[model samples]
Structures are given as structure tokens and as C-alpha cells.
Target: MLKSDKLERLELYKDRNTQVFLNKFLSEEISELEPVYDPKVGYHYPIVEAIVGSVQDAEAFLNRLYNAGILERRLYDKIIYCPKCGSANVSVRYCCAYCKSFDIQRSALIEHVKCGYMDVEENYKKGNKLVCPKCHEELKKPDVDYRRAGTWCTCKDCKKSFDIPVVAHFCRDCHTAFTFEDAVIKDVYAYTLREDAKEEAARGWVIIAPIRDFLLENGFEVESPAFLKGKSGANHMFDIVAYEGK
Candidate 1:
């Protein structure tokens, strides 16, 4: 059961924006509000953005509702961003382990079973045919004369060979290069309306109907679920708006 005083204090369903936002869930338009990752804006809720007009506003509104127990949030993802400018527009780079140069080439390593010779595939190339560098034997087919053992990499700048390369990140927004240690990690969340709140919202008008009856019996013209413009130029909704001889 939901407390009427708490709902009134938080201005929950009475607000027009709150009603519209929750109606999407009541009508089954969306099951959950998932956070979409945008390079320029980081994690955002597109569905909420369409209603609230901006990512920042959507974030604030959703978090407020979540804190008030109207919505539930779950961790969706953990994304890495640029610590310098705090942007999620980051790309990965593979560099040579020895010299940290991006100029590198990868090749498959071939092994000749007969002579037990293993080397890069380039060394086995001979006039459109595979010839073992150690035994000088013409390789016919795979698993018979030779087989692919693994892969190897060579750095063109430092002339160094290695099995793995170093991983690094570059920010597209700020043009900054950094490793995982220097990057910022943020947790993204997805939101959904709470089941109890959904039930309460369905019968919200019933709970506030006594106020409407009281105003009508007092000889005042009343409007239930009325919208009025505020001083800030924002429209607000009320459960009952009573007018005196208007």
C-alpha cells in the first residue's frame, strides 16, 4: 500500500509530466528505459529524452523518481571514458609491446610436422607454394605436410617480434591518449516503474476524489485533473481546481 501523504509530498501522479511519463509504462508502451551510449553525451535514455527534452533533465527526473520509490533502477553497463574531458567517445588501439608503435603486422605461424619446423607463414612462401624454410620441402596440404600453429606479430618501426600487443585508448573528443589506468569508469543504469507504484497510479484519482466532492458540495465549480500555467510558464496538473462563480 502507498501512503497518500508521501505521494502528495512528492507531487507524484498529480503533475502532468509525471502522469505522462508513467502512462507509458501503464499502457505497456515500454517495458524498461534502457540507457543508450552516445559518444558525445555518454549514457542517456532516449525515451526519457524525448519526453524531458534533454539528457541532463532526463537523468535528474529519472533519478528523482527512483529515489522517491516510483521507479526502480538497475546497473546496465560499465563504460570507460576519457578522464581529461569526461567523454565516452573513446577508441581502442593496438601497439607494439616493445616500442609502443602502431605500425605492426600480424601473420599466421605454420609448422612442418615432418622436420618439426615452425615459423611465420611468410617464411614458408615460395613462388605461390609453401616450402619449409628448414627442410625445403614443398608443403602440400594442411594437417598432412604442414599445419597452422598460431599467430605472430612484427613491429615495422622497432623491428621487434612479439606474440601480443599493448592495448591503449584514444579519445575522439579531446584527442587525448590514455591507458585503462588513466581512464574514467562509469556505471550506466536502466529504469522501470515499480509494481506498487503502477497499481497506485491506476487508482490515483479515486484516492483524491473526496477533495473534489467536498469542493462541489460547498457551492464551488470544480475541475478534476485540471492543468494550470504557473509563474514559471510551466503547466502544472492538480487533482481538483475549484473556481468561485466563474
Candidate 2:
């Protein structure tokens, strides 16, 4: 059971929108609330948005429940956003490592295993036949004569060869260009009801009120829902804690 304050906090779920959100889990419609990725919004819980009005409102409500220990949250993904405007609508841009030019060509590096000669595939093309540029050997079979060594890139503007390119991001919303170091990163999480809270969700708080009244009538000071600290210094919640004189 939740503490008295936490139980009071549960009253927020009584709102129609919140009930609709919880009912989905209560009815076993969804076991976990996973976020859907949106290019415009980054990561959002669609079901929560549909029930709770907006994405921001849905996230706030889920966060509140998590804080109250009613829901458990797990990191689902991480998204990068534009730092300038804080928008997730960003596009990735790969540029040449030398001149930062967008005009670059990608080709596979082929190696003649027989002679240990390696070069780009384009240099080995000899009128529909692969001929090793270094050894001038006509390739016959894969692994026998030549094999794909690796992928290589060349900048057309600078005519420089490189194995890796410079990565940057462009914000569609603010039209701002930035690198990974300048982008804002946020963690997205998925939520599920706490194991103990599932049963309480299925049965409303009304059932617990009568039990609390019965204890009070029997000449006892009762905390309907209480937090008790254990010997280990851990606080555990109880449905009822009653004291009859000391």
C-alpha cells in the first residue's frame, strides 16, 4: 500500500483523462507504455497523448505517477535535438573529412589476395572485367583472386581519400547547423505499473476506506496507509498501521 500522502496523490488519477490512461493497463490492453518515435517530436507516448490531451501533458502525468511509485520507468532510447531551438526535427549530414564537402563518392576497396595489392574497385574495372591495378592480374573468382577489402570514400571537391567522414546535424525548425557535441541529448523512457499497484488499480480506493473506518471504530489510532521505517533504514508502505495505547 502507499503512504497517506502518496495515497492522496493517487487522487489525481481519478480525473477522467487519467482513468482512461490507467484503464488501458487495468484491462490488460497494454502491458507496457512504450514511446513512439516521431521525427518532429523525437519520442512520445501516443496512447497517453490521445488520452491526456497533449504530448507534454501526457509526459507530465506519467512522470507524476512514476515519482509516486505507482509506475516504474525504464530507459527506452536516447534522442538528439537541436540545441538552438530545442527541436527534435533534425537531419543528419555526412561531409567530407578534408574539405567538408557534401559531394563525395563511396566505393569499395578491392584487394588482390594473390599479389597482396589493394585499391578502389573503380581502378580495377577493365571493360566488364576486374583487373588488379597493381599486379595487372585478371581476377577470376572471389577469395581466389580478389576480395572486397573495405569501403572507402573520396571527396570530389578536394580529391582526398578517407575512411570516415565528418558527421553533422541540421535543424529543420530553426535552420541551425551543429555537430554532435553541440546537440542536446535526452533520454526517453517506457513505463509500466508497479507490481503491487496493479491490484489496487483494478480495484479502486473505495474498498480500502471501509477497512480504515473499521480499525478506527475499534478504539485505535489508525493510519489508513502508512510508511514504516525498517531496521535496515528502508521505508516500507503498509495498508494500515494502528496503535492502541503505546
- Of the candidates shown, which would achieve the greatest TM-score relative to the real structure? 2
- What is the overall TM-score of model 2 with all chains considered together? 0.74
For each candidate in the order shown, give its overall lDDT on alpha carbons: 0.82, 0.82
The residue pairs in collision within model 1 are none
Clash counts per candidate, in order, are 0, 0
Error of 1 at 156 (Å): 2.5
Residue-level lDDT tens digits of model 1 in 1-246: 345345452466666677788889989998898888777888888888788888889888887788777888899998889989988898888889998887889889999999999999999999899999998999998999999988899999999999988988899989999987897888788889989888767666436656766778888887766679999999887656889955
Give the local distance difference test score of model 2. 0.82
The C-alpha TM-scores of every prediction are: 0.67, 0.74
Which 10-residue window in model 2 sums to the lowest lDDT? Answer: 5-14
lDDT of 2 by residue, 128-237 (tens): 99998888889989987889988899999999999988998889999998988998989899999878777665444445556667877888787756779999999887
User: Which residue ranges in model 1 land beyond 4 Å of their true spot?
Assistant: 1-11, 113-115, 125-131, 136-150, 204-246
> Where does model 2 exceed 4 Å of error?
1-17, 203-246
